[model samples]
Target chain A: MSGTALTQQRDLFARLVTLGEEVTDALDHTNVVSTLGEEELNRAIAAIGDRALPDAATSALAALAASVERVIAANDPHRAIDWIGMQPRLALTLLAATLNPASLPKDVVPPSSGATVAARIPAGISFSDAPRDGRAVVYSGIQADPILRPLAVAIANATPAERLIARAVMNDPEPTAAEAAALFAALPSHRTTTDPLVVGALAIGGKAQASNAQYRGAVVEATTAEMLRRRPVLANDADRLVRRERRFAIDGVSADPHPFDVTVEAGPVPELWDCKWGARGIDASLLAELEDARIRAAGSSARIAIGVVAFDTAAIVAARLTIVRAPREKTRFITLETLGRLAAG
Target chain B: MARAVSTPPDAAHPARRPARFATRGHDAAAAHLATLLADAPPHALLIVGPRGAGAGTLARDAVATLMCGEPVDGGPCGACRACRLIASGSHTDLVVINPTGESNTIKIDQIRALAAGFALFSVEGGRRIALIEHADLMNEDAQNALLKTLEEPPSRTHVILAAAEDSRLMPTIRSRCAVIRLGLPDAKQASELLGERLGVDAPTAVRLLRMSSGRPGPLIDAEATGDAARAHAQIRRQILDFAATQPHARLGQLGALVADARAILVAGDDDGNAADGTESDDSSDDAPDVDAEPKKKSPAKRSAKPTPAERRAAATALLRLWRGVARDLALVSTGAVDQIAFPEDRAEIEAVAHRLPPATWGEALHAIDKTLSALRRNGNPELLLDAAALSWPTL
Candidate 1:
């Protein structure tokens, strides 16, 4: 934490808070908060965080906190702590930093000290570490399940190379030069101080973003095309379903208002996918939005749970990363490795 | 050119590509790739499968499709010169880093070299495709170096990691690339494909397919490796006899057998000169004549102990042999006789299966697996084998 880094981080926090406030106020005008239950508010907040908002703003932060406060009308002390347990600590810190204590869920106080900011969800994990101050994010929880234990350890004790790899895989937006140097130095040969991010961008032609978009498109189309090539599963399934990039409007006939990145409506529920590649890859926001979509589409006769398919694993990791957002137990997260598993399922 | 005629005239055929991956169980993968490339393939791929699963072939095919001017049939149309170069592995645009020989470890330098090459423009005016075979062998640094390329590869570049064990790869590496795991073909599909491709009869095809766990790659390429298989079969029989020996005598016999085996295979080379030789000679004098060696009179002067490499290879081969035999017993016990790797040993296998219950074979398999695990962790070969001999079930 250099002084400059601190300033930049604070600026980022401020900007994020301002954005959240604008969104929150818009929702308030529509009286969406009045209709939302605590679970839904939590889901909405998770979605907003997924958009990569980290910095904060004063007025907007309070306003956003106020909007959510209306949904959970409690002054109970334990209630606030419980609410804080599931909340994205960093975003909530920024939002609540300026709010009157009453606006926060009953007993919850934002992480400004040694509070258990990040709670361990599994009943057995006894993690209780909070950030020492407003400027840090501490991870103290451990997953106790046998299957996940190894993965948790591996993640916790990730080598520098692994960290670099994770950052790259996630397409983390702000990979430092130090990471590049560390990555290069860690390798047995061809050690250099040159940035690896540059190396990545150049591995594919300057057209990676464009290329991935194509890959994303292909995954959607080719899976369908392969099915078509094999023959129709049911007669005229293709005729009944149309792929919609737009969200299916409330009026039910808009060309462009689909809640997802790609949607195909051939089956009982339209297969909704939110495709992304990069560091901010899979986050609380997308899962939150997808969760919201799943909730909204529950009443539709031909609705499917919004499925997430990431070309990059970072998003999947993010989806699993329970520290920031609540673990999306219900959402289906798909990656390249699990393609066969999904197909079989 | 008269080269292109069916229902329509063709300029180039897909067969012009250097290698063709025609596996039955992986037809769906191949077809899916074709469909993906029926438009444009993804820039990075993590191909997961066991060795000899046509991982390399699929990678090449994908590259060929990407770099070809007028790609056809999910691959490069062969009629073009680029396709021919791709087939011949002479195309400048295609770079394959095979971690074989002294370069068993794909180090960071190799990836750096690749990154440098990728940093430049493509020579063939098409996508630059780099195939990393046995990518799981890459040292951690190499994988890290490769991260950059994986994240945002060069312009018109496609990087494919052909890995045997996906778990060996960093999850980040696994995450960055799209993974496609190739399945082993069923016995019937393998038999059909082996018969069709190699023109082998149903019985031979079945045996080959069974030996390869229903994967046709090894069977298709069997002609090249047939001698080694035969040689190892003989070696296995010797090891099995040693295993059947009384426990008290096993260690002494094992030491003598290895020395004799090494001497016979290495042409009595006293100088450990052939330690790193890739191929062990198929022919070896079976006589265990430790007394016959001229240097036997002077224990201090005996200069012909196997080199570390030879010793390691021998240990590995022994473990493999034990595993193979134990596997046959287990398979027979399970009544999966058709899945036996050594179809020719049916009589002996049946006898073993009948003489001992499936539990005996199961115990043997478990012991063998444990021994192999210890050996992998750099256990002293002689000591480990001695322990294994006592613990292993007698046929």
Candidate 2:
């Protein structure tokens, strides 16, 4: 790069950081981040990273610059970015960082932006409240009403242990051994992990499935088992055998029970155990199945217990079972916490 | 969540036209509607708007004109037999599908029945009309069920689906209709209309108009329900009560309050035990009482919120209602005479009449807006409630 261009690039980096700071403040204060054109920041980011750029890069860059200018015009110079709202600011900043390779610190890993952020935002909040016609809210912690700034900062600064805890807390209100396994699977690369590809594979079940209120616990269990296979300490070459499936049935005097909607089978389970996921543990209504399992495994003993897993504000009472007795009636009920403690031990 | 806001059993008054104001910014849309109504095209027509913006009146007017069997310019001749029946909501050709008493959703089956009827014959022996109110509340299945009817509307059958929220309709549903949008009158026009037409005192009419956000339906409905002014007072009072409470505990209390309010509205004062014993005694006498219970229960329950999600939801809902009420009251305060609020909330309205300055109310609104945005993220719901819980009382 020529001296003038190099000088301009250095100036651009400083300007970008300042923009980031202003965007953060704007989000913290008001709602104006939608006035941002992320494309402009991408070009700057691309130049900083010295990598190839897409054909659309130039137009996107112009749009970003124009948006910034619009934001400036909407408010006084002193209050330029300070007037934006938190949500829009966070959205714009996250969007810019996603497009720019250089934004991630040397040690830091990056996540995708746009629909990813939209997806991560909890369901109950309405995007309708966000200004649809103009700008998204800009938040960076320097505003009178700082909503998620501190939380964002904490996530950005999390240590390995803290990140693990944060991940678990975010997933299951009550982090169980199963939940931990899912969190482990979700962690960023460069964090110490036994096997990266295995962890990635585990998360491929996708957050959409993982965060579902009904399926989350089961998803955690299934994902954790997969994560363990990466290291083999928990289990090796074992896959989920079957999971709970809802089916309408008849209480007939004579009829065979059939299940539909979903089913699973172990790839190879001569040396493996099946996993069941539940909040109050498996349903009490399913006790007949437990008894049947016990009867089917007469040579083996079974146990079942209710587990109390405490989250930040709530607790899930679950039932865990291990087939040790042959008779289904001989099956035992154990709480999941006890199992978690046992696993931890 | 909608409740009666007007005084109870006002001296009987003659039926008048559905409330209306000057059509602004929507002349082209309205003109398109007029032409379609003139031709009585086989296609269904959907008129959508925010709650209280008067979409229903537009639909009613269009139907009246189509079935008039006599033409006088583009508007309906209010004196004609067809116009009279449509206005009275008893026209055989005009089918109105509303929630059955306490039922909330406009069911798919209900739409199917309406479609079937439309498929049969016209009562007016002219254009068959179906006006579905609160059209947005239709579930996806119901919306889809209406799609076939909407896409290929029967000969001489006109369907007008009106909603307070237009976005709630399926794009497919929307694309099929010629949409007519309605908006609240400007302050001056709304003020004049309320005073001359509704018999509201000049000053109170202005207040009702401002409080109703210049929207004629809500402006009229608020007076009828008598809850608009009362709700504004209750919201203000509740915010003050919450503001005094510590943040952490306030959310839980607010949430509990909201749930309890819903329960109370849904269940009412006859303690479950008492109701069981009296269940067979006087069903008719008890039914109205039961109906009245929810009217009381809803606002109280809605005002309860401890978690941010519930709090923000409650607050946002309240704000939507508040805009109309405050507009009514503001008109009253400003001495504008176009709209008169229902007389029921007169007492509460008077009590809070100048408790907070207008600017402070504006600030409280902004704070509520902030809480709503935060509720959208992964931020703790409790914290969001905390923010509102703190700011709400100060207003």
Candidate 3:
């Protein structure tokens, strides 16, 4: 493409992004937009036509636009609710179309075929199950696409840590025991683990890391683990066994078992730590989760100490205030430093 | 008989004797409230306005009128025992609720307690008033808890809610209350009021009034308002400076811009919270005592290291400022310089506007807005800022 054409394409992309943001905002709140007009929606629909997007993507955009226009015309009180229902799918389609327009199929693929392929792939590859080669085989299939070739090359040139994360996200086979151990050991000190390529790979393949919220949760988990390992007193606790992705049935916590990010089984009382990434993350849900855990632990003779490890001091403070109504003697709010001290004792 | 000395009306001491409800440019609202007080007032009244629009003042004035033992022109006879008690914040029949703690939210427990208080008869055998400031900050459960009170308020009791952003209130809660919307005050009147309140000269008052978008409430704290005005001016200059630099140079200065923005936010918060005195809940025992280490430095020095929320708030504020600049640039470019927010910096803004097309300013505006939304949703601040920087038009 010529320079002017590329610039035009970029401008269009930015407009689409803005439209997406406005829609998302409107969906988030009822009164964000006093009047939901179709001017922007129409412009976005026209812009999508101008792009070389796949038929499915184009149809999806058109449908979303039509739905929004219909809602606007109806002047429905639940217009925000309708928008909320439709925005995520619209956003996902826009994201895919914008990210790699060249890779999109000229001919629409069957949904069942796609689902079958997805099913054939493993659910997830555990840290111990990653391939030793550290090659992201998932990219091999898409390397032929002109738009993604540069991204593939970028991944090829990424650091070993990034490659290992990318490989794990791609559901590749297990790495050798030594290689897995080395990579796991290096994760605490790895500065570039959140590289764009690695994050992109995780977004594409890891269900848990699909959204920004979940991605931040993962990053916070890593940081918490790193901080825990950095403290010698906590790290050298012979009685302590730290594990992630541990699910426990704490009676009324939930109908199903609750999954904790990090569970430390030390002495008679186990410690359940849930990592809230930011101030926004420390919300009502966190309180409910912590409260449930506390109630469950109490029911079981107060055998577990509920802890929340949050990075933001304001978030920790907010969470503490939010849960002050409950009996919180066994529940502790912790930063990484405080968590280390508590463990040391 | 010796004449009693009467102090001059002051914004800080709003509850002084002879409560005049002297807000300028709100004559219609005052009249409406007076009419309500003259007869049966609404069981629940919602006073809605943007930040610094004086919703709190209006609410207080209305409450004082309802609780006043002696009425003067449909306002409080501030010399009465009841008025004196209200002024001292010791009125048994008047209860005020504010968002508590670092959470800056009115939780359900507070609302429940308020409800329990409503069950009692008024101490004065008169109307009992519950005033909730920043009612928009009430969480979902709190709002829900308030819905009951709003729906069936007790006999001889009034519930007044003052919200900067009333849209955040639940529809059920909003529906029950008689809504009184406060728009931006008349500019000329606002400037005059600000001049009298801040004891500033005409030009300075007008400038400060423009900075506050014609809100008189924000001018009560002359020092904090001045600090905010200076910070805004600095941010405008930074934007102009950034625009003057090459694209690559602009990218290089991003870190400095972010740091400066964060510092300005910290300073603003420190000054604003202190000046307002509404956020006293931060010192409550309910505050998280996890970080028990005492820091004996000034608040500014201690808060220099901001939490993640603070950082996000700073970035959001910076982007908002950038959006304003972009808007000003657009206005200037379109020969609508009179509509620009930062009138004092018109020449500098025009200089940059001359360098860029109107389309570029529009694009920057949209980019900043998009980044703002993303930042609110907890997007990585640095990455979002980087993306926004790339979209910024360079001179």
Candidate 4:
């Protein structure tokens, strides 16, 4: 190659490097990173890596992608539903379609953006007169709200090891505030990296609007699972699965059944039911995975019965062409309306 | 997914004017309203449904049917002078009111005008029907003003209160009015309806119906004005072109795309691009709060957030294009050519489908679904689009 050709190529190569850094820096602050997020970023990068690129530029591009991936991953999961008043099934299902199957960093499903279990309150004050924030309100020393009462009691009531979580949330002044306090009680370590994706002039701009809400976003997600646990029809139906005196309610308890959100067994076959309350229906991946779980569980029992019940949500299931004529047929999509009929069945 | 639906043609009734009671999917609600007229019509009627779910249309139809001199078998004879006047929105007996402020609230002043009109005898000597569009847009004060009129509307007068959702209405208003909730027709019904109205084939009707969310009223308007096909075609083209465009260029394009999306969804034709607007439920009116006091809006709200009502209606409308594109991509990836939303874009969609494994299309579809949710949830548009750009398969 001529020296001039090499020089032009070098300039182009330098620009490409700069471009990668710029996109990542821009993406870090953008919703794209927060939405497609770490899992998507990594997978896309891996796919690109499978393609051939110039040896000299490969390392630089890979490093840029990695830096972008880390920056995106380090942040708290964006509370995707915060703006809306009530969860709408279409909104939730459409949002679910965007996510890949790789679990979130804090894998627990987030709460309905506008919904929380109505807290039990002290006498005399009306429901509207109660405090809307996370802090457990007290009036004349009476516990004014019961949204967090379960978690508070659970922490106080657990044998020994469980107290550690309760103690941590109590110590952290931030998470202890709001209707989501019980949610805050069970939280991963709250921290964010100060590192930038690029050096000097290429450093990320306008990144991380760090605030109390950032930490609160992830911590509050814990309560949504708990809310689903006490849901009348779901809990009652799941109760039929229990053979022993014990009932499974923990979010990610080691002893809890796998491949289904709530599992129970009364007959020869173990009955698995996954429950969701997002206004929007679920995405194909979540549905596909659960259906696969049912197929897997079918080997153990004569009749494998698995059901997914949602409140105000539907699933946009995918199909494998001729074998699967309708996505709904493969995965029986049950609504809260249908749950009433299943009460006896 | 806003793609062409594959519905079997019902050719005998190529143009079945099934909107007899001014509704398509709401047969039961229409029947109930008809039954009320069988004796004495209710003093106040609250018609509720999701935005674009045809509450406004039903309200208007009820008024037209009530006032039409030549009543058909069940409802309004569309050929009558009263029906024509109502269709033109110039009838003296048919009064229409809407939100007039940035907060999108129907103030007490509008209610007062409605009262004055209702107090008078009908010019055509028919029932005085005051059709309040977006009745929930009435704040506490406006609703209170409405409550009095609703309490005992004149013996011969009728007030049809239309709302996107019932919760937004005051309890007093809700309690006084008999409610009629409307829903969407199944895709098949919507397709047949659209094909008849638009003078299109069943296949084209189904595609258009899917995009319009199966509402014949909007589909017909969009077809005449060409906003539905125009916005979708341009947006779909832009999405396909996104792959070849530079990463930096794509960033700037997102702002335009989002803006166009909001307009197409919220203000179907008012933006000059839309042919005509949907009924009073013109959520396709995704215009920025330019009319409102801009200072009152938070910086966050100014950028990405839509009102809760718009989350499922207008705001998500733009995503219909994306949904269709994603759906077609998934179909192509899965080798389901017959189910493609955009047959014209098949070559491009198939090529793009090849870039990612068939399974990835499911994730892409889900991702778009999540994007819509996030957008509705008020997630920043730039941030949300950026996430999608990151996740999209690279060439």
Fraction of native Cα contacts kept in each candidate? 0.00, 0.00, 0.00, 0.00
TM-score of chain A of each: 0.33, 0.25, 0.36, 0.28
What are the per-residue Cα lDDT tens digits for candidate 3 across A40-137? Answer: 33333433444564444344334333434433444433323323322332333243334433211111111121111111111221111123232324
Clashing residue pairs for model 3: A129-A174, A130-A173, A130-A174, A130-A175, A131-A173, A131-A175, A132-A175
Model 4 lDDT tens row, B196-238: 6667777666555545544454445434324545666677778
lDDT per residue for candidate 3 within B65-85, as digits (tens), equals: 888888898788888988899
Maximum-DockQ candidate? 3
Candidate 1 lDDT by residue in tens digits, A1-345: 122322333343333333333443233211211121222234325323434332323332332233224213423222222222122322233333222212221111111322222222222111122223432211111111122222222222332223223323222222334433433332322234333333432232122443433332333333332222222322244433323233543224322222354444433334556654321245667667676655555533324546555432221232223222532444555432222222222
lDDT of 2 by residue, B1-395 (tens): 11111111122422222222123324444555555555544366667654444566566567677777775666676778887786576888878766454446678898899888978877658888887777777878889999889777788887877765657789888877766665543466555655654566666655555444444443443232223333343543453354334333454355444433223222221111111101111111111111111123334344332433344334334433333344434444444434524344544444443554544444444545444343333222333343344334221
lDDT-sorted candidate list, best first: 3, 1, 4, 2
Worst ten-residue run, lDDT, model 2 chain A? A311-320
The DockQ for candidate 3, computed on C-alphas, is 0.03
Ranking 1 against 3 by lDDT, winner: 3
How many clashing pairs per prediction, in order?
A: 39, 98, 7, 40
Better of 1 and 2 by TM-score: 1
